[model samples]
Target: MKIAVLVYGSPTASSAAATAYRYARAAIGLGHQITRVFFYGEGVHGASALAAPPQDEVNWGQRWQQLAQEHEIEMIVCIAAALRRGVLNQQEAQRHGKSAANLAAGFELSGLGQLADAALNSDRLITFGG
Candidate 1:
């Protein structure tokens, strides 16, 4: 099966991203394909390179990055949500007069079309959100 998980809450405040991560890892481990992981709302924060967690806490941002790298997951952040929250890509930062871009590696900034596409392509579109 091809699964698309949509995460729409904060990394620390909400466990949506963490739940999505576990679902993705488990699905892949069970011989399923993760078509895409869509980050929306505060879920975009998981892609921020500047996110710092306490030493004892799980660094979800880095964990997502590593999961993408290790499993070749297609991780995408909602551009509208990201832009509203000040998460920008290098090109977007330059165009919008921002000082920094922290969308980070392994995650792409994309529009709703990507989410729609993932929905169409996926065998199941599961959502994790508040």
Candidate 2:
């Protein structure tokens, strides 16, 4: 199956983000293909390289990065939502005159058109957020 996951919750605020991550892992373990993992709203935090959780806590951003690296999943953060939340890529940071880019290595900032494409092309579009 081709699956696309959309997350809109903050990595620290709720389990929605973590749950989505687990689901993606399980899906891949079961031999399902994940087309994309789209992060919108507060979920864009999952793509921020600057995210440093407590040592005892899981760094969801790093977890997602590892997952993307291992599975080659396309992890995308909504550009508008990410920018609003201070998550910027190199190009966006340059364009907005920011000091540095914070988007993690395995993630990219994109538009809703990617989400639209995911929905249209994937067999399932699972959303994990409010």
Query: Which numbered prediction scores highest in TM-score against the true structure?
Result: 2
- Residues 42-113, candidate 1, lDDT per residue (tens digit)? 999888988887899888888888888887788999999999998899999999999988888888999999
Going through the candidates in the order shown, the clash numbers are: 0, 0
CA error at residue 44 for candidate 1, angstroms:
0.7
TM-score of each: 0.95, 0.96
Candidate 2 root-mean-square deviation in Å: 0.9
RMSD of each candidate? 1.0, 0.9
| Per-residue lDDT of candidate 2, residues 5-122 (tens digit) | 9998888887878999999999999999888999999899888898877899889888888888888899999999999999999999999999999998989999999999999999
Residue runs of model 2 more than 4 Å from their true location after superposition: none
Please list the C-alpha lDDT of all candidates, in the order they appear: 0.88, 0.92
- Least accurate 10 contiguous residues by lDDT in model 1: 63-72
